[model samples]
Target chain A: MDETIEGSFQIIGGNFANAGEASMQLKSKLVELGIDEAIIRRAAIATFEAEMNVIIYAAAGRLQYYITPHEVTIKIDDMGPGIENIELAMQEGYSTAPDWVREMGWGAGMGLPNMKKNSDEFKIDSVVGEGTTVKMIIHFS
Target chain B: MKLSSIVESISLEVKTGKNNLQNDVTGVYISDLLSDVMANSKEGNIWITLQTHLNIVAVAGLKNLSGIIIVGNRQIQQDVLQKAESEKITVMSTPLPAFEVAGKLYQLLNG
Candidate 1:
């Protein structure tokens, strides 16, 4: 186990071309830091889904990564139209994305569920008309 | 199965990452949705999709996929090809739709 390792990244809304960049970067960092490959894949998948949520739904956001010897934690806060129904939003195959977003091979209503599935710990909070934030944690052991 | 053999069997056009033809293919994953692939795809699987975008390359690289085969003869963007080459993610295509291509690949891999 090592000391705490931390980093942050910015995400721009509607930026489909660069949507996965942050997750890729974080995954590379985890690889460089020599974390377990399985754990890193989970974290990377969770982060990518969260990042895509920001791009498709939010106007902008920040993704923060915190790593300790025992676990890896990811925090994402976005400025967008917050979810009105968290339960409905959590359902698989439920999506509000416009047709255009769907055309890009995303907005399948799988993003949030996939994120939750990949995280050892997951929590989300949102305020209608304000914004949304997601936190995901993965154990290193 | 190696990517080259799959391409040869399927008669796919190699779009990029030609140098990576020797990458091993453990199985196949057929999907157009990005998150589903991210969550369910196994490493070394060959991805079959109609999506032609740069993010697919990123996803394939992230998942350590053996290669990507775009179906339906979709016109893949140039930037997507460049990204695949740089990442060494083998990319190929076929005029056949997803089902036919997937069937042929499966037969080649299993038969």
Candidate 2:
């Protein structure tokens, strides 16, 4: 509670079999830290969405989390084709995922929106032909 | 209602986490889409879906859902069941589609 808890998880892109593993681990860690139930749920949801994005689009990525007494911060950095239009990608029901991804009940274009909704602070940056980075912070009051 | 009651009432096949059948089911949310469930489902709600992938278990665990009902009698892979068992998330299967499963759950929980 007094000291900051920090950890990082490796994410393998295009690996549907293990897509949500990172988020699951993060959730377990948060639970172990005795964070509020509501806050842990929000943090887990946000982290899961971010993890899915990395797997569905990027080649690989790393998810890092820092939990302090004040806030929980999640950072995801991936290597793959970056979002060409952040605004368009942010729109609800707008997605560029392929047909195969759609059939799996994913690519709903709701990932980013869900992350933002669950986090008190959300930021995303991307470079075309490069990769993307997403940062989300949830405050504990 | 307890998950065991629903499982027996509807003849749902317990795939894994049989020990967790006593979990309380607060509500029902039917969606094949993972994000939709994550965004809307409440804790202790039993998720009804046709999805039988590994990520489904993760979603159920992350949301603290009471259990998952795989509708349409979809064939769930071994790894998914293994993960569900490890996470202690009860997963059941039904021959009926999502619509029928949802209807029956609604009646059981409300009627």
Candidate 3:
């Protein structure tokens, strides 16, 4: 395969109604492009987790996707109160989400870990007062 | 077994997406957390949950799930029902708890 396709989506924080819309659209595009079903599922799940993070934690964010013959790359940057402890955040069952957020059946403290589990490669960086940025890559064979 | 069969066997109420009742269900995942379902649920699995959000339909679509069975007869908002219908994902309901529905589904699929 020889191709380059790139897309970007903006996510508003606290937008519960459209939380996972970006991931759903990305999954549909992958399906239309005939990506492997397994790969698509993995990428879709990862994307959804990242998208939810933006909605639950950030003020606003943007998710960018770049697809090539070899891999799909997702870069998400959000403006919000960043994580104080990256290591603790990566641990499952550690969440800072408020009660209202959890009431929506999310904020299970699984978002970042779940994204890492689904992606072939995952990296996250955050500044306590600034924001967070995540880089995830999923390779296709 | 077909999702419709599961509905018939369990006497589930078809809230919407009835057209997709013939879809095959290969497995079942019981969860209310969206991320848990996203990370672990497999394609063609019948997701049993109490979530009545539109995002559930979106997750079911992205995961290619067979259908969603809302337990406890929780009222799904109109938008969620519409989204499930448009996604062509079967949405059903049961007054029983998630465990009871899961047990019934497991027996039907395994026995």
Clashing pairs in 2: none
Q: Please give, for residues B1-111, the per-residue lDDT of candidate 3 as tens digits.
A: 888888898999998888888898899999987888999999999999977656788999999999999888676667778888888888998899999998887788877
TM-score of each: 0.58, 0.58, 0.58
Residue-level lDDT tens digits of model 3 in A66-116: 988788999999999999999988866567787568668786667888899
Q: Which 10-residue span in candidate 2 chain A carries the lowest summed lDDT?
A: A91-100
Stretches off by above 4 angstroms in model 3 are: B1-111
Cα lDDT for residue A4, candidate 3: 84
Per-residue lDDT of A1-141 in model 2, one digit per residue for the tens?
A: 789889898889888898778788888988887889999999999999999999999999999999888898999999989999999788655677775796687875678988999999999999999899999999987
Compose the digit string of candidate 1's lDDT tens values, residues A20-60: 88889889988988988998999999999999999999889
Score each candidate by Cα lDDT: 0.87, 0.87, 0.87
Q: Give per-candidate clash totals.
A: 0, 0, 0
In angstroms, the error of model 1 at A13 is 0.6
Worst 10 residues of 1 chain B by lDDT: B71-80
i-RMSD per candidate, Å: 9.9, 10.2, 10.1
lDDT of 2 by residue, B10-34 (tens): 9999999999888888999988778
DockQ-derived CAPRI band for the predicted complex in model 3: incorrect
